[model samples]
Target: MEVNIEIPSHFLCPISLQLMRDPVTISTGITFDRDFIEKWLFSCNKTICPVTKQPLDDDLSFVITPNHTLRRLIQSWCTLHASYGVERIPTPTQPPTITHSNISKLISDASKSPQQLRYTCLQRIRSSIAPATTRYYSSRCKNIIVTCGGIQYVANVLIEKDATRREKEEAVFILAQMDGYDQEFKSVVLRNDDYADLFIDSLVGLLSSESSSNRERENAIKVMKMVYSVADPTRLGSVEHEMFAHIVRVLRDKVSKEATKNALKLVVELNPWGRNRVKAVGSGAVHVLVELLLDERLDRRISELALVVLDQLCGCAEGRADLVGHGAGLAVVSKKILRVSHVASDRAIRILSSISRYVGTAKVVGEMMEVGVVAKLCLVIQVDCSSKTKERAKEMLRLHSRVWKNSPCIPPHLISSYPTN
Candidate 1:
């Protein structure tokens, strides 16, 4: 016999609207499933209790006491309805505790004593950077770290003159991971001009440090990328020239594939500002991008990013000069069209269009013909490409067909596709 048992409305979590498992009570006396409430408080950063509408604690150290009574009642009800296919709820594991008081004491002692205890605390938190595969300790420790000024403490480790290089690297990596969890912490850190300056300076310094390992450079670039993700245009535009300089240096140095990719993205994001475009160009960004585009083994994503940056850089005269100055620049840009993804092809066309429209002197247009740029544009028209890309390609072809249509570089097969004068 099959029976559908109706779950009692009162036993449902207010947020999930599902039958409550491991119910827990917050200070507002409202009950919710443990997972749902924790997600609400920690993940969603909601300050108010869901049902009661009362403001919860600001520090995220507020306790969520397990409602053993309600949990047992739900379990018993599930058992009673077992015949109807309702499985009994197993005993839930106890939630991890956030010892705010203990963390605060540790931070205070570390600041005052500055000895073995501080190092030990840092080591413990440092080890907690592992992902929360199953052990919730890392997540719990991070919560404790943030609520008890442990985040600031960790950031301070980077600023500590006495801290070893390894210590600073570890601290930077830890804060970078923590940056993923809490937007509140990010906002708080960025709001303080002193902390934000120290944070950025620490990353830039570590990246450029002679003693900094490849791993350290990779981690620093990753953290800087994450920080830039949350920054507004004004803040992004206001970033220091040294920042842009080192970012280009990272790309130029090719510290690691991941670091290069991040630097490319950072360049793309920051180049919208006139000052940034000028600074990045002066930092030899256009030259590095042209070289990146010429890499035979470049990943599609990196290629796409490079072309996008190139497309932006070409907006300035110096950027265009650098692109044209490279022997392989026009050829590489032409090669990527229709060979990579749609975005890549679009950017490549845009780059060509920029040169043809703004910077195409007779020698430049002749180089375009020599490099098979005209042939690639003709190919774009014959293939299945986006309308916008095809239009741009056609535009580039028509703009220069008088000079390039009869060139020996154009394949006989693609000549018919080129627009007439």
Candidate 2:
């Protein structure tokens, strides 16, 4: 029979409401479990003490201090109740101290040494350094790691043919986490053309690899987005067609909502560059986006992004043909006109305008009317939307008025608002 012993209320962490293991005292003199407090301050990005609600120091390293007295008390209590199904909490081992010099040397050795040494270094980083240190000193550690050429080292590990699966996953995690620190790290990659190509190629390989996990592919997509954000027009224009194909594949898979959005954003980023729009079209982006839009459960921002990409793709003849060719393309675009946000509505109108202005063959125009697009245009002119959106709608209506003005496809209610000119 297990004896029931109530844990002392005072011995519990204030945040987690459990007996404190590795108890630590904050600057506010409040005791909490180290893991809980670190998660609160670091992972949650909180700056106020949970108990006293006092402001914490900007330098978090000084804000948290280990409470040896409280820890021993809890340990003794656990020992006394060991026979009653309680286990004594062992003293916590100190995390290995990481300094800038330590990181710099580790990166240097990894970069210059043989593959064995490089693997060992990666192990040290993944096990001892990143997880142990990131919990308490994430911001400071990111700066140090980036300054010590950690990005390049990790990228090399990701692309290394002989790297273990675990090591490559760790590298992907590090690269994804290391972004958004500062532009200095990105600028380094951007300035070196050969390194940039290798890095991009590795990421594209991951996206295209069947063996790569969804998490890995998502991280790779994130890193690609960051890289392209800072890439010059020359570099963006020179992106390989295979990369566009893999990106379109990501969209079609709907890997994750965030990954999908990043994929869309990546296409938008590259669309304006030389031949990228054509590349995207050849990769079947238009068909994928139209399919994505047909799903009614999409997020508002996603709808906006899809519309935006479609609009950009339509700038090219190939993109326009793809949209007009899809069975639901015109219908989906017309359906979103007033059903989504103002931005979405505007982009939808722009797509219609593009189709009407360029590809408005008699058969296409007749199909547009049958699909309720001609009616949607009349509604846009009547509704309280942006002036620019209203103008585009009016322009499309006037351009097609000769054919649609007296057409019965438009409802009588919306006919009054149709552009007369």
User: For this target, which candidate reaches the highest TM-score against the unseen true structure?
Assistant: 2
Q: Using lDDT as the measure, which candidate wins?
A: 2
Query: Whole-model Cα lDDT per candidate?
Result: 0.79, 0.82
List pairs with backbone clashes in candidate 1. Answer: none
- Residue 50, model 1: lDDT of 84
Clashes of each: 0, 0
Cα lDDT of model 2 by residue, 315-335, tens digit = 999999999999999999999
* TM-score of each prediction: 0.71, 0.75
Query: Which ranges in model 1 have alpha carbons more than 4 Å from their true place?
Result: 1-109, 131-144
Scored against the true structure, residue 403 in model 2 reaches a CA lDDT of 92
Report the Cα lDDT for residue 39, model 2: 67
Steric clash count of candidate 2? 0
Worst 10 residues of 2 by lDDT: 55-64
